[model samples]
Target: METPIDRIKLSQTAKDQLLKLRRNTKIDQWNILCRWAFCRSLAEPTSPSPVPIPQDSNVEMTWRVFGGEMSDIFLLALKQRCYNDGFPTDKETLATQFRLHLHRGIGYLAGDPNIKKIEDLVELATKKI
Candidate 1:
C-alpha cells in the first residue's frame, strides 16, 4: 500500500535549523531529528501558520524513514491535529499540516538555547515556551 505521507522536504531555513539541532543533540539521522521536531511542534498549544513553506532545500526523506515503525500513528496524529485545528483531513491538507508542523518543530529545536543535549528534550515536557 502507498504511504499516506509520501515524502518530506525542508526549506532552506528549516534545513539550517536542523543542522544546528543535529549538532546540538548529536542525533545524526535526519529522520530522528525530524521526529523530535515533529513531536516538539505538536506539543505546542498554538497552531502552526498556514503559510506554505517553500520546498527549496536538498534534504529529503520518505515517509517510512521519517515516521519509522510508528508511521501510521504519526500520520493519524497529524490528520487528527488537522481535524482539531478545524482544517480538512484530505490529502492536501494533511500534507500541508505535516510540513507546517515539521518546520515549526525544527524551529523550536533550533531556537532553544538549552537544547544542547538529548536529555534536554525532556525539558520540553515541563517548560513553558
Candidate 2:
C-alpha cells in the first residue's frame, strides 16, 4: 500500500513548540503529540493557511507511527477533507494538506494558554474555539 504520508518533518519552530507541549502536557511521545496537533488543526472551522513551512528540524515519523491504530480512519478523514476543499485525493495533494494542517494544528495547540494539563485536551473537543 502507498504510505499515506512518507514522513513528517517539523520546522524548527514547530519542533520547539512540540517540546513545550511535551513539558506542558507530559506526553512524551512525538507521535501522540503530533496527533493532538493534527486534530487541533482539523477542528478549526477555517481552512489552514497554505504558507510553506520550512522542514528544517530532525523530527521525522512515518505515517504509521503518527497515525497509530487509527491510521486508516485518519487517511479517510484526510481524503474527505481534501474532497470537501475541492482538492484531489492524489498523493501530492494529500501530503501537502497533511503538512499544512499538521503544522497549523501544532501552532494552535502550542499557543493555547489553557492547555497546560492533559485533561485540558478535552477542550479541543468540547470548547468552542
Output the TM-score of candidate 1: 0.91
RMSD of 1: 1.9
Could you tell me which 10 consecutive residues in candidate 1 have the lowest summed lDDT? Answer: 1-10
For residues 17-111, could you state the per-residue lDDT of candidate 1 as single tens digits?
98898888888999998998899898877899878799899999999999889898898888778888898988887888889999999988899
Listed in order, each prediction's TM-score against the native is 0.91, 0.94
Compared with the true structure, model 2 gives a TM-score of 0.94
Kindly state the number of residue pairs that clash in model 2: 0
Tell me the lDDT of model 2 at 48: 84
lDDT of 1 at 61: 97
- The whole-model C-alpha lDDT of candidate 2 against the native structure comes to 0.88
Candidate 2 lDDT over 39-81, as tens digits, reads 8887777778889889999999999999989888788878888
